[model samples]
Target: MTKTIIFDFGNVFINLDIEGAIKHTFNSFKIDALSEEMTAFNSFYEQGLISTKEFIEFYVENFPNISKEEIIDIWNFMLKDFPKHRLEFLKQLKATSKYKLILLSNTNELHIDSIKKTIPFYDEFKNYFDAFYLSHEINLRKPNKDIFDFVLTENKLIANECLFIDDNEDNCKTSKFLGIKTWHINPKTEDITNLFKLKSELFN
Candidate 1:
């Protein structure tokens, strides 16, 4: 029986223009593509290995033409809207007290701060979760076995009894390999509000 539901924040709840963000970054930074070191630096930031000040400084030093304000705006451009119906669905699910609701997302400080500022019910949404694990806060990220292990161990949750839902295929794969049930949700055609109807078999 599924006793817990683990959710990914981006795409699963809030809409993110990942492709557009990448293109925007390339244009703003005047870079054709991100280098290996650049990718690693971003990963480090997401894992909370670097502070926001350090992250901003690194960008400023590398791309001398861009101001800190511009960099921050570009960084937070990917995050879009949080549909009301999704929150309502989550509210209903929380009211049931049927399962342990956990939110596990690979997010950074700047993005989170932007979310809090933009989303009026950000705190309310967070309060619904029994445990909320942000990658930056926890120093862990999805698709890394350590994060999955950490969540399971910390929460005393059985892998088979928990369903991990993420838009990232690799993340879902990792959770599944760890013996957790997973739903690789496609945001374009799927809505999280249709969870029980879409994954009814998991509930049974």
Candidate 2:
């Protein structure tokens, strides 16, 4: 039986326009996508291996023309909105006493700051989770076995008894390898409004 639910916050909760942000950044920089640099920097930043200042400095040093504020704006452009319906769904899930809810997200400071501004009820949303783990704060990230192990250890949860939901395939794969049940949500097709249906399957 699934006694715990681990949720991923990006596309699962608030929508993230990663492609949009990349296009905007490329337009602003007047260059092709620096996919390699972005991937490397993101990995470091999400793992808490580098500070926000260091991450920004790396970008600034490579692209001399991009101002700090502009970089921050482009970086945060991916975080667009927090639909009220999603928040309501989460609220209802929290009200259910059947499962221990946890939130695990791979995100950095710039995106988080942007989200706080867009979602006025950020603190209230955060309060619903039994465990809230952010990649930057935790010094670990999704798709990494260590991070999954850390969460399991921290919560004293058995992998078989937990269900992890994420939009990323790699994350779901890693969790599955750890013996945790997973839901790899397809944001383009699946409606989060039907989360109660998932709950029924998980709980009943």
Candidate 3:
């Protein structure tokens, strides 16, 4: 019946460049691809396993030419905009109290602070969710079974009765494997405001 809705915060809400940050890094380092170690460091940082200072230090150590401020700017370049209509949709959805809404986002401290400055209604948007779980804060991340399980157990939600929405295909696949229904949103073609209209069968 989809009594609970799990929402992803990145592309599903705020727009992201996804590759913009990497492109900036590659330009700064004159490298075409990220090293295996570099990828691991980012993953570790996303999981909140590393401190912000240490994460910044890794880049400082690798690219001595770039200042800390420049690194911070490149890292945060992926975040774009948060559409007001989406926030309105979420607010209306919350007001209805039709479902238990949970915001599950794979985000770090810097990105969040950046959004707060750009998105004036950031805190107001948060009030739309019954529970807000940020990966860095929770020490858990998306596409990880443990994080999904934690949300399920904590909310006393049956996976079959929940719907998860994310812009990442891998995340949706993982949630599906855990018995939760999913919508891998296409930001260009689909708007979350039309969720029920788009997935009418789910309601029926």
Candidate 4:
């Protein structure tokens, strides 16, 4: 039986328009694609190695014409609407108290600030989780074995007894490697609200 449930934040709980955001940023910046250096910087920022000020400064320096506020807006373009039903489902799930609910997300401070502003019930939604591990706070990101190991070690959880749900296949792949059961949720066609109904076999 699954004793612990790990949930990914973006695309699992909250929706993200990654493609749209990229397009908007490219259009605004007059660039075809983000440079390798720029991508690396973003990854570093997500890992909490760089501060938000540093993140914005990188963009501002690269795009000399862009202001700090514009850079922030562009960076936050990926976050989209968070449906209420998902939160309700989670609340109900937590009410059961059957499994330890943990939230593991590769998120930055600015993204979280944006989430709070966009999702009115963000605080209530967060209350359902027993452990909330943000990449920025934990200094670890998904798709890396270290992060998974940390989670298991920190919670004193056996890998086989944990179920991780993530929108990204790479993240799920690492979890599976560690012997953790995972559901690589397709946000386009699948809704996390159907967790129990869809994964009934897991519970049994």
Best by TM-score: 1
lDDT of 2 by residue, 1-204 (tens): 889999999998898897898899889878786778777997999888899999999889887988998889878888877788888888887887778999999998888888888789999999989999999999999899999999999999999999898999999999999999888889888866676575457543
- After superposition, the stretches of candidate 3 with alpha carbons farther than 4 Å from their true spots are none
Query: Cα RMSDs of all predictions?
Result: 0.7, 1.6, 1.0, 0.9
How well does candidate 1 match the true structure in TM-score terms? Answer: 0.99
Model 3, position 63: C-alpha lDDT score: 90
lDDT of 4: 0.93
Of 2 and 3, the candidate ahead on TM-score is 3
List model 1 lDDT by residue over 58-171, tens digit each.
Answer: 999999899999999999999999999999999999999999999999999999999999999999999999999999999999899999999999999999999999999999
How well is each residue in 1-204 modelled by candidate 3, as lDDT tens digits?
A: 879999999888899888777788788778999999998888888889999999999999999998999989989988998999999999999989889999999989889989999999999999889999999998999888899999999999999899999999889999999989989999889989999899866653
Which has the greatest lDDT? 1
Worst 10 residues of 2 by lDDT: 195-204
lDDT of 4 at 45: 93
Q: All candidates' TM-scores?
A: 0.99, 0.93, 0.97, 0.97
The residue ranges of model 1 lying beyond 4 angstroms of the native Cα positions read none
lDDT of each: 0.96, 0.88, 0.91, 0.93
Ranking according to TM-score, highest score first? 1, 4, 3, 2
Q: Report the C-alpha displacement of residue 30, candidate 2, in angstroms.
A: 3.0
- The number of clashing residue pairs in each candidate reads 0, 0, 0, 0
Of candidate 4, the 10-residue stretch with the lowest lDDT total is 195-204
